[model samples]
Target: MVKNHSSLLQNKEFQYFIIATTILDLGKKLSWVALSWFVYQITGSALSVGIVISASTISPLIASIIAGGILDSYNRKNIIVIENIIRGLILSLIPILFWIDALDLWSIVVVVSINGMLSSFTNIGSRTILPSLVNKNQLESANAIVSMTSQFGYLIGPSIGGFSVALFGEPMTLFFNVLCFFIAAFLYSLIPTESYQSQNHQKTNVLSTDNRMRKFFFDTKEGMTFLLKFKPVLFIAFITFFFNLTYSPFETMLPIYVKDILLTGPESLGFMWTAFAIGAFLGSLLWVKIKRTFIYSYALGLIIILWGITPTFFVYFSNIYMIYTLMFIGGIVYAPYNIISPTIQQILIPNDKRGRVLGVIGLIGGLGFPIGVYFSGMLAEFLGASTIILGSGVLTILLGICVIIHPSLRFSQMTNLDNIKENL
Candidate 1:
């Protein structure tokens, strides 16, 4: 196992891919913070901020369906590089528009929507390309490494973003974001094209435009059908959706909880998130060292149970330090599910169908976040954020228990691709 991991690290193309993804994640996080602050600064209305944020969030969900077909039909490496380049070019307009005093709220929303839509392709491409980069035995380690470095962006991006805005202003901060994306694109381009040659040689093509559209829909339907027929993947996807639904409230309501419940300031909220990011980063590292192969379904259930339990403590604890500690521990438990779930999918899904299947899974799982946030916000207005959060935690715990006891998931374990295909 250690030898495989060491050899995986030695693969220079994989190294470039990881660095590119980390930089891409950092740019996105930084831009999100900068854009949110800028929107609020200009409008002084939380509603405007919500509109802009929702534009970015909702656009990606809409694009994932098309993104899946594009991923399968195109070279994923080229798609990733092109997407990043387009994103950088689009984001450059923000700073330029602001400089010329031509930037409007609507224009910002439009740019963010376009970038968000493009990002779906890059995000899915990153995952689908992973199986080509590393051997199956090294997937867990590769995933953990990817997750760990990517979490580094989450850990520092917002802090740097806020500081950059204060010191350099929104336009400059946005320019910084553009720079990050361009550099990430360059890094991705550094990876030799030959690395993905085997994966891309099987692309499907149609000469007729009408037939291409028809083929696209047909491929999309086929992907969904495969996901439904594969019971274990289907079950995991459902669990992921439920998990997002129950956990999103914790993220969406954290600021209010810090302010009203803990009677703290923005600094305290920052500290809490930082603590969680630190824990998540360490957890990813620890996961890389762990030797045992998990029964993916059972392990996910247990992880979710622990994850749900950690946040429930928020209902009881009023101490800010205690909350930070719990957030840190919660982060640790959350890391494993992210690593295990995708690794299992990559192992089981054939390379030909992998992109579309992952895309459908992405759409199914992604729906929970925006829907949960929307409803949770509405419910919080009536029941209070604390009550809503408590309910989310409890519901999550119940869902985890359901997974553990469910006839399909309970008996499912990690298996080789051949066995999974045979069973299917």
Candidate 2:
């Protein structure tokens, strides 16, 4: 049955969240092309691109951990709105520096790190807000809407960014991103926090610096204690660690993939991304309808296997159209993992401790990815991008197969949300 997605928009609060997220997605997509091209052009070295991007990845991980305290303690709505404005102002520096031809590599690295950390600081609140905005029955549907809008932006933004670089340059592309963040922030400001149902029951005094630091560590410890008792969360942590570890090398190697293996430019890269987004859009929509009977843990392993095998063929495909088709197919398998993992966290974790628990999940994935990125950079330099990516892909498939046979994951599947809430 075709679900009425329009009804989702009529819920004013969820509507506001979606609008803000969609705007941010557009900016993020534009920045991916514009900034990558700008850095590569300026430095003429793939290793430099790896360093800047790895910094962006690592900084955000650390911020999410630190922001755990803020998400559980402070006024989340106020922080998000203020953070968005700050992020916009910080990002505006890129275009300004580009205009003056004063964009140095180290300066760009610093800007990306600062922006990454602050951006994650704000997003922790928004990420945990979906359960409050929508009814439980509609949670999957709401996540699907989020995915669709985000992919819709990806479908449009990258092509425009890639073309605009040849037309108006990276400065104009970055300028577009600057506008999106500010506008998204305003839309966020309209959300009424009086309606926020999530709250931390424990009180902490933020008055003294020493007490505040102590409080932050205590809050984090409390969340970690709760997480340790839950086996499913640990299951996710295990797979996510391996998943991000294997996935990182491929991500860090993408520029070389598009350039060397595919023998293409940004336009082709844009087309590949558009294909991935379209698949994700449709896959997310499909999951909402099918998630009732879904075996959450089993499906996760299967998705990983599909992801691993698809890329093996992708690297071998000679025709560009064939490569695009494989990328699109890969995206469909990939979308379910993104939707399921977060939805389960939102469902199982207590609203009060959700921030820190999510922070823990972020730390696990983050730790693996940067380590993968660092080694991938060195490995790709010695072994070539093809060998590095292919090795990662094959190992991921084996890991998924091992997960399929594992007693923990096979038995870890939740019977129902009612059972889940009772256990949790």
Candidate 3:
């Protein structure tokens, strides 16, 4: 890890990339809290939370499929820079509309929908660029660092956003969000050109004008084809889908649970999320210590199961501190997967197909999130959030157990590329 950090810092380009990513992540985290609060404040309905999230979901799903192709067809650095600029401008509008008293629910939805589309493009550009920035052996460390940074953002951004919402109202919080984006954009400008490649840099389109979409589909097909050849990668993606599904209700409806059932206000609800973020950040740091251990998957499964089940108990008990403790405890297991999953992929996948395969993983992962959020929300309306969350835990535990029963799906003791290849 030290060696990886040294190399990452020694590379001037990567230094800039780190700054850019860290800053952008800050904005991303803050916007998450800000938007959710904005929606809840405006609509005061639980289902409205689902509607707000749908804004992000609809466009990103469509854009993510295309983003993989774009990743393969463009200069990734340019894409990153451009996307940030666009996102900055778009997000700025939110504050402007709010200040003008013209910000309606529909307007917020429209802006966020655009935000999601741009985010897909931005995510693809950045994720694909990582392999090019660092040595293959260091990919795991680099990914770990990135995951850690993200958790750090989660740690700080929501707390700050919550405070901002309380002190300055939602519009000013959004205005600060715009500033964060520009800061990210400026940092992105400092990254060197050597760190990235244009996928089809000089190649002209060979497909007929009408066949462009067909060609795009065929390109996406290549990513799916690669994953189809790898069982571990497929299993991981499948497990991630279910695991993510289990976690979605917390993000989408947990605030409502805190507010309605537990009688906690927005500030207190934000603190609960902050508690989750703190756990996640600490958990991310722990990845550096146990990264080589064989118990990684088992630990992850246990933590996730806790994530699902703990809320059930907390909701009934209505003890905020207990819920907060569980949230933090859950974080310990939560953060490593972010580190390990990407690490597993980097080790397992060749550079040639990493973009496409990761894109497919993103697509599959993406599908699970909205499905989880929407379904859990609907279920909460029919049953209760506690049942939906608890059931999700049970489902995740069962899924992991099933995967473990298949020896092939179990985590291997392999460490490096040679062992990974031999194991696979």
Candidate number with greatest TM-score: 2
Q: Tens digits of per-residue lDDT for model 3 on 338-404?
A: 7767777767866555666777877777777788778777777788766666676677667556554
C-alpha TM-scores of all predictions: 0.89, 0.92, 0.90
Off by over 4 Å in 3: 202-217, 295-300, 414-424
Task: Name the candidate, 1 or 3, with the larger lDDT value.
Answer: 1
lDDT at position 82, candidate 2: 84
Model 2's alpha-carbon lDDT is: 0.78
The residue ranges of model 1 lying beyond 4 angstroms of the native Cα positions read: 36-51, 93-108, 169-171, 197-210, 258-268, 291-294, 317-319, 411-413
Candidate lDDT (C-alpha), each: 0.78, 0.78, 0.71
How would you encode candidate 2's per-residue C-alpha lDDT over 115-157 as one tens digit per residue? 9898786566766778888877667667778887888888878
lDDT of 1 by residue, 1-424 (tens): 5777689779998999888888877777678667866875687544465567667867887888788777876666688788888898998998899999999999999999899899898777778778888987788778888888888776777667767777788788788888888888888888876554434235454346676677778887888888887877777788888888888777666656766789865456556766777888988878767764655556778888988998889999999889989988988988877787788788877777777888888888877776777777667667776887798899899988887777664433445544766877
Pairs with steric clashes in candidate 2: none
For model 1, what is the C-alpha lDDT against the true structure? 0.78
Model 3 accuracy (lDDT, Cα): 0.71
By TM-score, rank the candidates, best first. 2, 3, 1
Worst ten in a row by lDDT for model 1: 197-206
